[model samples]
Target: MAYMSGNPSNVSFVGAFLNTLGDRLFSAFNVAVEANGRMARVEALQALSDEQLAAKGLRREDIARHVFSDIFDV
Candidate 1:
């Protein structure tokens, strides 16, 4: 009795896994780009004067937290 049976199910499973992996990789890349954008925003904001930042309702100390506000609960 041959214990190994070539089946289409196995191929489908592999394909599905690869697709999921690719999606996850793309999502991660997008998140990285978004984070970088947030960092840049924070840097630009920091370069502004305190009065300017206050006008925008932002504080120097809150820059990082503000940038990641959408990503984190804080």
Candidate 2:
């Protein structure tokens, strides 16, 4: 008669699953932070007086567009 031993470790996929989850969570956090920062900039610009805005070469109507100028051409 021969005796057989089963596999010792069973949770083989757990590490990979945790790593992927961590990466996704980190990416989401970064996106939220970036959007928050941009919105803050937009709000700051909106609070400025027309003269103050013109001093910075930005217009009230173009607040969002100006804040995102680096990412957009408008």
Best by TM-score: 1
Model 2, residue pairs in steric clash = none
lDDT of each: 0.89, 0.87
| Residue ranges of candidate 1 with Cα displaced over 4 Å | 1-5
In model 2, where is the ten-residue run with the lowest total lDDT?
3-12
Model 2 lDDT vs. the true structure? 0.87
Worst 10 residues of 1 by lDDT: 1-10
**lDDT score, candidate 2, position 14:** 69
TM-score for predicted model 2 compared with the true structure: 0.71
Compute each candidate's TM-score over C-alphas: 0.80, 0.71
Q: lDDT tens digits, residues 1-74, model 1?
A: 65756787998999999999999999999989987988899889889999998998988898888888878888
Kindly report which residue stretches of model 2 are placed more than 4 angstroms away from their true locations once superposed: 1-12, 72-74
lDDT of 2 by residue, 1-74 (tens): 97656543544476678889999999999989999999999998999999999999888999998778888886
